[model samples]
Target: MPTILHRRWLVGGAALLILLALTAGYIFLTTAATAPARARIQAAASMRPFGEVDQEVVNARTLVEDTPESARAWSVLGLAYLQLARETADPTNYGRADEAFQRALDLDAASVDALIGAGTLALARHEFAEALELGTRAMELNPTIPRVYGVIADAQVELGRYEEAVASVQTMVDLRPDLASYSRVAYLREIHGDNQGAIDALELAVSAGGPAAENTEYVRVQLGHLYFATGDLARAEQIYGESLARLPEYIPALDGLARVRAARGEYSEAIELYEQASARIPLPGTIIALGETYEAAGDQGRATDEYQLVEAIQLLFEANGVRSDVELAAFSAAHGDDADRALALARDAHVRLPTIFAADVLAWSLYRTGAIAEAAGVADEALRLGTQNSVMLYHGGVIAAADGDTDTARTRLEAALDLNPRFSPLLADRAAAALAALDN
Candidate 1:
């Protein structure tokens, strides 16, 4: 492995090259009409922060207030809002981002910055098609910009266009192999069942680093998740712990440590960690994790309360025009909340996105509602990408068993266990029991 100093030197050189390339792209793409606003916004992007990007939001908002007619100013505000949303796990920022981006587009429909910002917001809201469209438009306007390809690749991946996503990610990394592009590479590698390759790419991303501590820690948490997913609990815990040590109570690191604790059967510790995360930000995923930890610890009442909080957050998300159907469908099906509603949400999500994850949730919901054959078919769709996600495998295994495909059930269940025996505190044991029953 290269030393951290060596990696930093390489990244610094590459960043210099990227800066020159981006400068050229900006010159070529910027018109006299938008040049001033665009230059100011791009300059603001270079302001390094200690641990948060909220300062960017403040700066952009001030700029927009001063120059209300500047489309680029509004676009940067939208982008900043999106960044704040990611850091805080506050879905309400989605609404602010949408409004700001829309205003930018209303002022200048051809603004590439606004288009990319809207695309990112759409991606966050699970509107894969819209994200793809906006990203494509941005690329057409300014193909030299590397980050546009990140948006395109992300949307392509979610839309199940794996080959296109791969090509886009390749182009991105070739243009600028920084944290953003390298992370995309890692994701594509992971979905192709190449865990080690993914880890290698993510390590490179970490070395490339980011302008904000949150950015680096966010990638670190993802690295930890990959380790945890592959059953390297100790490494995952170490990574999460180190991240939390560097940035006290970072929500993603806290959640990761909680997961590691739960996997190790330290339910009390897991519960405490998750509660801390939830208190910091009532993100649906954190709430769901807290609920599941409670369920694992035999605290049904608290678990139910946490689950209800998730429902309330979902409602808030919907009111903000952010879609949560796929997530809600999977959660409802898993918890036996509302079979009909879950199935409906799953179908709607699949119709809108048709992603592998949506397919998995649809399959799970169908199975929960007793549509065994249909569920099996959808489960196959979910596995079509050969992604090595253990939860999807577990769902596939159970659905196959229900559909009377004993061989497939055994194979998928075995694969899930082999990949990660402790994939989920709530479901891993159930998967093992099902596999044992099949053997019997």
Candidate 2:
């Protein structure tokens, strides 16, 4: 037990012990401002593959060319590009989307689709203020639109307005019970500590969004993730396999399957799956997981190699005008020994998003920086949702212990183990050791 509870992060074992208390909370997204809107358009955040949804884009383009002044067609094109941007993780697609949406607005100053499209793009780009403005305006223009509620809900959660988010999603579901509404409901349910409710809602979404293409594959992977979080590896694996069966080489499903492998102590297999996932996405998180699993298997050299890739990726993302603070903060916190760097990255991330994920990293980073008092406050905030994140609980527990709150510390550490004892090969043992010390 040491500073930041890395199992080996040994700046101050005594301080880590003292900080090992307190817990509970959710993991909600962050953005700001609230606008209520209602209109009759299906949720458009499917984020399908470019090839699969290229037809819609082409059709929209054709319509615009044939009818140059058609705001509807222009809005459709904008939305298409927005989805493409998300699917491809390409920033340029956002610019194209913005242009199309602006054209729609120019042609029809009051086009609700254009407004919603713009708002969606803003949400994607982390422009919470603009997203809120557009969401509110779209709502006023068409109060019955379900997608408006989604946009409003996303914005509200980012702004730390959980109450409004709940109400917005409620209105969305009440309007129509579809894939989008149900998925939001599921995430909100998880945030509220209703794992079963979240699972049930996703089940509904899976059933509602069948046919096994992009949407179904994505939902199934998410369902697998929930299952993994709850320590149901068998069911999670089944879901992931089914998803992969539907969409061979689906990266998310591959990642989920890899996680299941890691949990089951299938180290080599896990590494293979994770490597495949890395080949597919090259996301920092995937690389970090690969390294962590390698560490779990005692492959220290390989782990170091993977950890080194993080800085290069960060540099690349920066060069492309993408900060990606959340992932960077997480990567630094997990892999870097310099607590100062982790704290700096986490502080910036919290300022940018303020989501529970950011809050958790900030709390841990504060702990790493020896700001035990500050860490306690942010750790408390991180647990505001009663989330089942074992790492978050472990951090809160350790912080509480450091603060001399033995009861709170014990409870949190116990909860972390109960939620998922194997959450981190590194931290799980540390959590166990901390609990044993508390017992002594």
Candidate 3:
């Protein structure tokens, strides 16, 4: 937990101290920017993965300096800073983005570009209500823009307004049936228990291409994740490999392949890929996966180190005004440590953003803290949409078992294994064991 010890755990000898933040925001291609702004970003950014946005940021800054009075230039700079923040996982970039957007708004209060930029930044920062307001304003300014609907739909989804989110996504798709819209459709379908429908839409996204190579590859990673969720390890591995071939060492692809390897019990390979990914961006999810892989491989010491790093990173993000309460709560519940803390964090998250994910975490945390009846009730709400998420089903099964509902417990547990036998690197075997005990 000391500074020196943290330094020792750095992947590939990099400092790895600051949270290279993972983006939890929805995806947008941003194809509606001004010609100069788009050209500058596309030329400087090119097809080189989203994690490398330094050149794009530099180009945007130069343009801003060249045309200091142009609100569009300032908006582009703001967007560039926002992209840099997302790719680098550095919350400090968010501050720079905020300043640039404010400057743009000051110059032109009706700048849709600035509004969209600021709205997307809010999404990245997990301020769903603020993002919704900004997106709505942008939509009112230009209802025909697909990206505006993307922002609105993303915020609505996080705010637990599923029907509204669906309508927004439909509008986006009707306006522009491209990678961004199709991908959103895929997510909505997946969450609504239509796995095959999700896959079909993702395939459309893959074929539709994207604004950048990374965008296409990100969709591939998502496709791979869908397969991975269904226990189709072979297909998932193949898609991940294809993505890597297109964009070598793409973080999400590496993470996906690592997950496949872990599911297949190839811990060394999984750890190596995860190390590569965490070295580049250090997403909290990837770090946790690496830690869980280490734990699976019988390296408890290293696993503990990774877990400690996650805690440190979460604390750092909090200090920077990014709320990671749900993530932290899930981590605590999974690790079976500090159940009370997990419950409180989950409660806070559910109150702020009542998404199904928040509901699931809250339910799990409640179960961890021994509030079985409340946990069961909340778990039902988590699955109210009939989402086929194995982990949520697993949680429901466990909670039902605790409440002595043998039939429901058996049905839920069976459904979870049917969906994905290896739904979690750390918990899948436990689920099997629990199911076996119930049978006996």
Model number with the top TM-score = 3
Q: Which pairs of residues collide in model 1?
A: none
Clashes of each: 0, 32, 2
The true-versus-predicted C-alpha distance at residue 279 of model 1, in Å, is 0.3
**How do the residues 330-428 of candidate 1 rate in per-residue lDDT, one tens digit apiece?**
777777467998899889888876878899999999998899999999999999878899999999999999999999999999999998899998999
By lDDT, the better pick of 1 and 2 is 1
For all predicted structures, in order, the TM-scores are 0.85, 0.84, 0.88
Could you tell which candidate, 1 or 3, scores higher by TM-score? 3
> Model 2: per-residue lDDT, tens digit, 1-440?
12111112111000000100000011111222101000000111233344766776788889889989899989989977765554444445677888999999999988999998888777665566678889899999998988787788777776667778777777776777777777777777777776766777777777777332666667767788888888788899999999888878777788888888887789899999988766645555677889989999999999987787655555544544554666679878877889898999999989878888889999988988889899989999999988877888899999988878899899999998887777776788899999888878
**Ranking 2 against 3 by TM-score, winner:** 3
Model 2 Cα shift for residue 313 (angstroms): 2.7
lDDT of 1: 0.77
Name the runs in model 3 displaced over 4 angstroms. Answer: 1-52
